[model samples]
Target: MSRIGKKPVSLPSGVTASVDGQTVRAKGPKGELTYVVNDEVLVQLGDDGIKVDPRDTSKDARAKWGMSRTMISNILTGVKDGFEKRLEITGVGYRASMQGSKLQLALGFSHDVLYDVPEGIQISVPKPTEIVIVGIDKQRVGQVAAEIREYRGPEPYKGKGVRYAGEKIVRKEGKKK
Candidate 1:
């Protein structure tokens, strides 16, 4: 038996979960998310909580059984509480601003980089150097933040670029005299 698969998934007050064929759908205050379960895995809604079971006792079946359950649980939590990612600009003149539906980033480049905000995700600029990305889908929020950070990755020497908040950049020693 899988430890994580054996655990019950508690449903929140405003959240609803339903299993349709091989797919599990969760609806909450923020939004709804759907996950497809593997053929070897099965999910059933119980009176107290959700139960996950594997059709076969093979290694792959056991792994999928546990992973599917965890994914469903995360979807429930995400729809209820949402997700957020924060990024910071480190360069002297590098900054970010929200213009209409686009994000304008000045990263010491010849021209400012403009990024269009996708639907369902909200981008905010609390400070010119700080960016906050909010969304119910964890994957989408993370992807957007990563793309922005890739535009100007932190330099090893000066660490002057965009990076995740609270992230540490190791500085390398300069040339020896």
Candidate 2:
């Protein structure tokens, strides 16, 4: 028995959800998103929202049960409220800037790194050291943020790099003479 799968997803006001075949679609004021559920799990839309269940009592079915429910919940929430990710640059010369639809990053490299903005995702650089990523799809938003952070991941020694906001990097002590 999966705890998360047992709870039905609740549809908030101004949000509408529907199930068609194996795909679940959600429409809201922000936008619309869809997810195709796996065959190992069963999905249904009810008054409360969406419900998920395992087709059979097996390890694979049980594993997909909770994940399917969470995916459904994510699409509903994403279409309604969307998702956001923030990145902070720590290096002295490292910074970020927006060039129309492109994001330009300077991470102590000999040349600047340019990243092209994808559709349906918005990237903004409020300050040179702050990067904000916003989008209706949670997966896409998170992936973009990860890719940006990968440019200059934080190092333990100096802790100089780009990292997610509020992320704590464990600093390693320098080699003593």
Q: Which residue pairs in candidate 2 collide? A: none
Instruction: Give every collision pair in model 1.
Output: none
The deviation in Å at residue 16 for candidate 2 is 0.9
Worst lDDT 10-window in candidate 1: 42-51
Where is model 2 poorest over a 10-residue stretch in terms of lDDT? 43-52
Error of 1 at 138 (Å): 0.8
Give the runs in model 1 whose Cα sits over 4 Å from its true position: none
Off by over 4 Å in 2: none
Give lDDT for model 1: 0.92
Against the unseen true structure, what C-alpha lDDT does each candidate score?
A: 0.92, 0.94
Candidate 1 lDDT over 6-63, as tens digits, reads 8878887799999888888999999999988899988888887778899989999998
Model 1 residue 32 CA deviation (Å) reads: 1.7
Error of 2 at 39 (Å): 0.4
